[model samples]
Target chain A: MSTVRVVCQQLAPRLGETEHNRNLGARAINDAAMLGAQVVVLPELMQSGYVFKDRQEAFELSEALDGPTLSLWKSLAAELDIIIVGGFCERLDDGQVANSAALVEPEGRLTVYRKAHLWNREKLIFTPGTAPPPVVQTAVGRIAMVICYDLELPEWVRLPALAGAELLCAPVNWPDAPRPASERPGEIVRVQANAAVNRMFIAACDRHGEERGIDWVGGSVIVDADGYPQAGGNAHRHEQRLVADLPLAQARDKYISAHNHVHQDRRPGLYLPSP
Target chain B: MSTVRVVCQQLAPRLGETEHNRNLGARAINDAAMLGAQVVVLPELMQSGYVFKDRQEAFELSEALDGPTLSLWKSLAAELDIIIVGGFCERLDDGQVANSAALVEPEGRLTVYRKAHLWNREKLIFTPGTAPPPVVQTAVGRIAMVICYDLELPEWVRLPALAGAELLCAPVNWPDAPRPASERPGEIVRVQANAAVNRMFIAACDRHGEERGIDWVGGSVIVDADGYPQAGGNAHRHEQRLVADLPLAQARDKYISAHNHVHQDRRPGLYLPSP
Candidate 1:
């Protein structure tokens, strides 16, 4: 069934400490590699934490796509011979910063995606990227990357699936808002909903531990193509690494058999633009 | 702040038996009245089970809006002095049948909402309703009714909210699907998402119990205006009712304070319809 081991690391990072965050990221990668994970994912804005008091603070944390942070990831990917996906703040030449994710291959090849959907406070610091994310062909399988709020939008996942992605990777830093226990199930439900609707494996990695007085809800999960969660992090815990074997063939089977190919069903003529 | 009590009834019907179903509906109404619920909601297609085998079976189950089903509900609402929201199969003059819900006031006044979004099997038996579900002003509050599939679409809920619906009553008969214990949190999550996004109290009534060998995943919930599930139905049991006292004023406060109005922020000029 072409099973591949994947790990979602719910690593907590100290704010504004790039070097410490890089070390933490490396440690997570090393641990997952030791456990035989072919691919590993980390949370959004891992290097800078999520809460920024101001736009200038967020901009100060931004780095070029090929900057030192990515160079460190490339080295780790090459040393571990594993695929690594993680989030970072991207500083563009035009003086704009964006919430972005990077996918580093074993050969040190890197592909970056800027977050398209910006959440509250994020709009102040990051400019939404215009380009759609591409599903790159990797040695393990075809994978796509999305950042935080982007995962909440259906089109973000759907477009990648349409572009031939078998697996969707999301790195998130979800803020803890006080919610009743009855409302706790929403995260898994949304993941499964996305997985089933797209007919693809989803490795959604979320941040854990409190930083800057804001608690990040870390419940990283690996959802199957059939919308079933295979493994990963849970609420109330942080700094945990979840590893599981995901079958590529089973995902393909589900896509071929059950997916109605909603794209094919699209009657463009009947659709009116939102207004 | 205004306070409103909402009851979401996850009711089940005896397949093909209107009399038995009517009795069950009346009993639930009586119980909700005793609990001091201002608004009581029943599931979609409460008079007949969700699955009716074939078109002929569905045709036989169809009744006019003012037929025996409405008459019974009217009397019950008046006797209890409570607002009752329930679903029925409406037979039109043109011989077309629609999956619909009716809002019956304490004085026996009724406003019917035809199902807008039809599911897979329903499309085979019923024609889509032409008019949008209108929000009806009541003694307790302004209420709106929507059938099962309508809840899945965000616009369906948003339109009513804009039309002055402080409370959204959704009558659903969701089929039981296999879910891991860990995934149980998904129900609460969806409820929270809906409540949070809409900024309105949601009384989601789902059919409970097994009928024709199909299990109904009963997680009927009463979500507060802030998206917190105040009362929830047990998934393992059948024929359960969830009663909760909801404060309408508190909902308005939360919605206004969040300033996260999806409808207001919608860039209608840029978006396309969902496929």
Candidate 2:
């Protein structure tokens, strides 16, 4: 009965409102900690907001690792004795910027992962990361971080899962699109599939509200190792808080059947490195 | 608009009832062709049924490429001017048996793919395949084939999708599992996610009815490039037929957004060959 209380705060951040967004993030973290959450996740680009007009604007909003937002998060994490995971626009060398997420532990340790697979206009706005998603061994459980479209690539997800990540926390801003009525959004469906295939838990925090005429799906979800939604598997078009207690132990046992172990059953020899 | 009508006939096959199962398959294929289907898919092990009593029993039911089942399918495919994809127990040298599927095109070209990933009890009963799933360039469109459990591996599915398979026709036997009410089965969700990530069309046919006290999910589904079900996305407990006219041209255009093409967007270099 080893469980971890996870929280995803689906918030709306105004574009370029760094100070306000930092406050919003602090409030969400405090609320989650009060509810006994051991790990709290926030949406992608919470510091500067998504839907940037151009690379120049994103660079203007980007923050360094020592910047106020991450500094505040690091302090809060240590003060609350909880782990915090959230996205921010990262300031890079030569006036470059990257979409990055930071995982701050209560012990003042930090691990950062830049978005590897850039979504739509993000190609023009940020430099894609060359390193794989980072899987950190935290006190609560082994956790990993990836951003938005990175979840779409199962190959990318497999890296961390094989590396012994029990829970994958993603910060996403899923844009709204027309879908069949009464069907789950494909974004959330993909997340469930990713979790199930690797026998890992996933908590994806998505943002709400429209930014520059782009409304989001607001489809934050937490799926168990079997890929079933533990909480918030719907598209709620408003600020929401999704909380779930995941039996992290279930992820340690990858066997779906007596003969099959998810990771061990894979035949990578047949799969080419790059096709 | 170049469209190809695909049909999935979910039928039950009595174990070791080769003659009866042949008639059942012939009837389903005829029915699909009558419905103007260019391609028809059937469930895994349709020729010999799943839930074998032992390895000896499965070997006894195994057939070669020139066996009556595939021979009949090849004749029917050429005669009816359509493609038929279905599963059977393949007899290998030295009394070995492999769970395999055959894709018979209108030109009488037969492509066989052995199930690389075996399920519970199957590993004891059958020899696992070493070859990857086969993608064939058919007259209707470029199609591929893989059997059940193999579908659970996204890396295996990616092999065909990356090989320019516009549509992947799978023959699956999804054993019934307890799922939350009003939720789509994880098997179907994985199918949708695979299609969406690859921007490829997929039609997976599952069987119905009880076999040796083992019931099935009967979750047959046909998903378009966008990962939305065009037909049969539910778990019906009886024999059923799912049909959809797929404009496979959409699969060729991998771009989901202005900047992201599903295949081109893949950062394969970062993904390890054997992770």
Candidate 3:
């Protein structure tokens, strides 16, 4: 069984507290590595926090991709022999900010992905990513990523799946939609459905606590190839770290039944490309 | 308000009892129409029954596209001034069989769609559909149909959504997976997730009762534009009929928030067509 240990760290990073957030992230990474996790994922904008008040506040909180945060994660990855994925506010050279996430490898190699689909107020704060997240080959599996609201688009996940992605990492700051407390949030449903369709593993790391007035729904989940929750599906409103063994190779075998291969059964002749 | 009342009929069809099954379906349609439903959906293979004993048995039960079942539905659709969508075992021209569904309109125009993805024993018995379901403009909304396991594919649902479909009719025979009876079935999660992602109404009609030792999970659901269950979510093991006002135009809008229009914000440059 070529199972890879995956971890999803659900932490509440205080707004504008970059140093404190960085410290929190370091502690989470260390804890996960000690637990034998080879891949550790963190929530969106954990270094700078989500829910910015205005443009000036967001600009002040944002930093370049080569800034202290990615460098710190890169060093930690090299030391621990782990792969880390996390989100941060990226300050661009052209005075624009991007809601970005990074994948840092054990060899200190780094690749950055900007959020392609921005949620509500994020449109006012950040530029939408021009390119999709790259799929990179790793010891764990062929891994790809989508940030926060990007998971809402079925096409975003399918793209990576077609490109041979076995695992999808989502760094999210999911706000609770108005619904009964007993129900699993819509975000959890999204991951489960997408995982089943793509026949892939998904590690969704979400934040907890209220960011400004917005309450984050802390249901960080790791779903297997069948869309069944492997660990910590309903994390609820608290700090939690979920780790599970994900069989990355099963995702490559798209055949669920004898005849139907998920991507192969697709009817492209009937579908038009999105504008 | 351009609200269209829709109904989902969750009725179990006894194996080989074709006439009885049609009667049961007729009764459900009458009930839905009494509740002022303009569109009514029924379970997969409700007329012929699912779980055939062998290839010979399945062939014996299969009927042509212009068979009595669709003829009956067409008469009822025109008589009641409603749209009907239901599944049947289809006997093809070259002696092949397809697990297919038909959408019968108020004008008595019939459109047929074969199930694109077959589950379990179905793969051995039926051919997978070559074309995706087509979206048709109607009084209720622009509607599309998929049968049973076809809903498992995100691409199948997305195809019709891109073509301006406001309503997706999923007629299914959802067998219960090995899980605790208390937990919501995975099939319900699939419809909810797909509905939420596509920003469209999904009326998923599922059968109940144990057919040939396979217990059907009867959680027929109607999800609105926001993916919230309008009615009959978790409709335990029994016969059920669900009716709800579906705001069809809301699906056309596709606007989740002021900044993000679901389909318009899609990044096609990053995505390749499904093979």
| Span of 10 residues, lowest total lDDT, candidate 1 chain A | A254-263
| Top-scoring candidate (DockQ) | 2
The true-versus-predicted C-alpha distance at residue B261 of model 2, in Å, is 0.9
Model 3 pairs in collision: none
Q: Clashes in model 1: which pairs?
A: A185-B185, A185-B186, A186-B189, A274-B268, A275-B268
Q: Write the per-residue lDDT of candidate 1 for residues B1-275, one digit (tens) a residue.
A: 55777887777787788888888888888898999888999988888767878777887888887788889989988888989999988877666788889999988788998886676667677877756668888998888887876665444566676666778898888777666775553444455555665577888888876777877778788887766667883464577778788777554443322433444534333244233
Candidate 3 lDDT for residue A56:
74
What would the TM-scores of all predictions be?
0.86, 0.98, 0.92
Task: For model 1, state the Cα shift of residue B106 in Å.
Answer: 3.6
**Candidate 2 accuracy as TM-score:** 0.98
Those runs of model 3 whose alpha carbons end farther than 4 Å from true positions after fitting are A53-57, A273-275, B53-59, B120-124, B180-182, B273-275
lDDT of 2 by residue, B42-98 (tens): 999999999998999999999999999999999999889889999999999998899
Best by TM-score: 2
Misplaced by over 4 Å in model 1 are A107-109, A154-165, A181-189, A196-200, A226-228, A248-275, B107-109, B130-133, B153-164, B185-189, B250-275
CA lDDT scores, all candidates in order: 0.75, 0.94, 0.87
